[model samples]
Target: MTEHLTIVDHPLVQHKLTHMREKTTSTAGFRRLLREISNLLAYEVTRELPVTTREIETPMNTMQAPVLDGKKLVLVSILRAGNGLLDGVLELIPSARVGFVGLYRDEETLQPVQYYFKVPQELEDRLVIAVDPMLATGNSSVAAIDLLKKAGATNIRFMCLLAAPEGVARMKEAHPDVPIVTASLDERLNEDGYIVPGLGDAGDRMFGTK
Candidate 1:
């Protein structure tokens, strides 16, 4: 439950996610809750980022102070719903560089097709975190990672609100080095590839897309 992937079970995260999954939660409420929970999830995902120290003068005296290492991190959103989570995370890591990978599933094929892709420069040098609210089938998530790799990203992490078992296995098989941090790992995906007991379509619920 906590090795290659982490299920964030903090009380705040759980409470917000519970509200988020309710069908009766309004669009504005859903969006607000998503952002709040994202901050909590981002806190856990970035916990092990490498850090360095520099000497600086404090109010009392000069001392070496800890700081995040290297250039600003790169946050790559997986489009549409990803943007909702992205906004919340940015409030926490405001200086991070941002990027987006837009993909939509082919209803017939159930495969991902990328439409837009742009990343910050020097991706390989900066830590990269990809955000998507739902990881149901994992096709789009995996494809997004593939594009990031081609763009020279090496160190990467994935964060989502909920994940299906199938999606987790797919991610583990495709990108074992990239860790996944999610609010919950739900049961199986339904016949149509939706996570069982999922919060409906994340993009629809969050944006009133319908």
Candidate 2:
């Protein structure tokens, strides 16, 4: 995931995202779809993870089997909506450590304000993947990464369900070294800083909040 941005356009990912975007979709349905899509996105995000082989004995033979190398990766959810994706990725990588970064947008300023932050130790020794449902303004994402870096994380990647061009540019400019992986790169953001043609406020829809 060295590229600045990676869009996963797999047919299944696109199909599930469509259903999630539908206004008529129920809360449970939206959540289920998000979890499924998260799995697909995780596959693309971890595509370049390091691997090593170890000799093992099979039923009737001995061979070297490839397995993930180094320390267990860290999954840092961006709080609230990020939990939706976190649940799915956890199922895929149960051994990975989990953490959270709590941030909210200041409507007037359209900036991010952090409220809470907690992550695993030895971040510099393991890969760090930050998960968030939407990358609308990118303020929160960039701010979160800033905190992660200050805490000793050298390798970090960002994962989101939907991203706006504005947010993508904001991230690239703020943190050129961190790569972004998303399901769709949607149209520009709206006046309120919402991703146009996006699946709406991910936190609201997933939680059935107004």
Query: Best candidate per TM-score, number?
Result: 2
**Clashing pairs in model 2, backbone N/Cα/C closer than 3 A:** none
The segments of candidate 1 whose C-alpha lies over 4 angstroms from its true place after superposition are none
Least accurate 10 contiguous residues by lDDT in model 1? 1-10
Question: Per-prediction TM-score, please?
Answer: 0.97, 0.98
Residue 161 error, candidate 1, Å: 0.5
Q: State the lDDT of candidate 1 residue by residue for 71-123, as single tens digits.
A: 89999999889999999999999999999999998878779999999999999
Model 1 local distance difference test score: 0.93
Error of 1 at 97 (Å): 0.4
Strongest candidate by lDDT: 2
lDDT per residue as tens, model 2, 1-210: 668999999999999999999989999999999999999999988999999999999999999999999999999999889999999999899999999999999999999989999999999999999999999989999999999999999999999999999999999999999999999999889999999899889999999998
Query: What is model 2's C-alpha RMSD?
Result: 0.7
